[model samples]
Target: MTSLQVKDLDSGYGRIQILSGVSLEAKAGAVTCVFGPNGCGKSTLLRAIAGAVDTWSGSVRLGDQDLTGLPSHRVLQHGVTLMPQGGGVFPGLSTKENLLMGVYLLHDRAQRRHAVEQQLENFPRLRERLSTKAGQLSGGEQMMLSIARSLMLNPKFILFDEPSAGLSPKLVSEALQRVSTLAKQGVGVLMVEQNIQQALQVADYIHILANGTNRFSGTPAEIPSQKDFMQLYLGVKDSFNQDKELHHG
Candidate 1:
C-alpha cells in the first residue's frame, strides 16, 4: 500500500522550531487527521510533507521514494498534491479554466482532456458552472472546485490544510464528506483540521499535536478513552492544574 511517512521530523522558520520529532503515516484508502489547537504545528507538519517548508532534520517518504528536501513541484510529480486552506482558487478564472490548470504537467493532450472530463463527471455541480468565475460560486462550490482541481493530477497522496476553515456548519460537513470519499477512492489523505467531530467522523487514524509535539494518537474509538483527549481540546494548563489538585488531595 502506498503511504506517506514522516519520521523524527524537525522544522521551522528561521531560528524558531515549530515541529519537533513529529512522526506519522497516512496510508492509501485511509484518512489520517492531525488535530490540535492553533499554532500547535499541525499545518507546519503538512507543509513539510508537501515540501513547501524545509525540514531541518528527519525524513519524509512515499512508499519507497524518499521525498525529504524535495521541491514542491517535484513532490507533486511523485503523486503528492496539497490543497491549501481557504479555497486556493483563481477567483477571476472560469471554473473550467481552474480545473484545467491542474493538468499543466500532463504533456498528452488526450490525457488532459480525459482527466478534465472525469473531474466534471465526478463533480456535476462544477460542470453546470463551468463558465462561471470561481469567485462567483458559493463557499461550498468554491471548495469543491479546489478539490476537483487537485484531482486532475490523479495524485496518490493529498495533503489538506484546514479544509473546513471559514465555512458554515453544513458546508463543513459536505467538505469533509468529499475528503472521506477521496480515501474510499484509494487516495492517501493527510489533513490538519480544527473541526474535531467532523474530522473524527472520516479519519481512520487520528494524531493530536500540542506544543509542537505529538500529544495523542489513536483510532476514533480509542480517542474518547484517552485521559488527555479532553485536556488537549481544552487548555493544557487547566487540565494539568486539575490533575495536580486531584493528586495532592
Candidate 2:
C-alpha cells in the first residue's frame, strides 16, 4: 500500500524553482531512498512534502489525506513526520527532557511519562543518558535521540533527510539498521541521503536526482547495475578527466 505520494510537484524558494514535475511514492513498511549530489533538490523535495516550502503545483497525499499546501504543524498532525538532516535534539535539554518534549501533543502528563519509558526501552543508549544534556552526547547518540524523538509521535510515515550525515562508518551502519527496524515495524520511510552506497544498501527503491529533477529511479539492484547510476551522481566525468590528465602527464 502507498503510504505517501507526491505527483508533479513543483516547489522552491520564492521564484526559484528547485523541483519541477517531480513525483514519487513510498510504500507502507518500506524505505525509499532519494540519492543525489549537492544542489540536486533532494532536500527541497523533502521540505516541499513536509510543508516547509509551498508547493507551486501538483499534489501531496499521506495515506488518503491530501497534504498539498498545508501548514507544517498541520501536516505533522496528519501522521506524516519529516525528520530533516541534522541532530535535531535540543542541546540545552536533558536527554529525558528532549524525549518528553516530543510528546507535548499528548496533554496527559501520565501518558507523556509512559511514552518516555517506552522510548528509553527502544533506545538503550538514551536510557543511560537520561540525565545528560543532549549537547554532551556523541554524534551517533544524538542521531539516535533525534530518531527516538520522532518515533514518539508514533507516526504512520516519516521523511528522513540524511539521517546518517556526520557519523562514523560504524554509526552509519547502525543508523541504517535502525531505519530498517522502523520499516519492519510497519512505518513508511522516505529518506534523502548523500551516503549513496549505504543508502542504496537499505533502500527498497532508489531515486536519483540531478540538477533539480529526477534523472533515474528504480530498485537498487537495477540502477546500480547500470553505468548511468555512477555517471548520474558520482561525478564519473570528473574522475575520468583527472585520470586522463594524469595519463597525459
RMSD of each: 5.1, 7.0
| Candidate maximizing lDDT | 1
Kindly list the per-residue Cα lDDT of model 2 for residues 1-249, writing each as its tens digit. 656888889999988999988878788799989887888898899889989999999999986899999998888888888887885788999999999877877899888888888888998989999999999999988998999998887888889999988889999999998998999999999998888778777888767776676565567765434465767565454321212211100
**Per-residue accuracy of model 1 over 38-130 as CA lDDT, tens digit each:** 898988898899999999999999999999999988999999999998869999999989998898888999998999899999999999999
Where does candidate 1 stray beyond 4 Å?
233-249
For each candidate, the alpha-carbon lDDT, in order, equals: 0.86, 0.82
Give per-candidate clash totals.
Answer: 0, 0
How far off is residue 60 in model 2, in Å? Answer: 0.5
Error (Å) of candidate 1 at residue 99 is 0.8
- lDDT, candidate 2, equals 0.82
Poorly placed runs, candidate 2 (over 4 Å): 224-226, 234-249
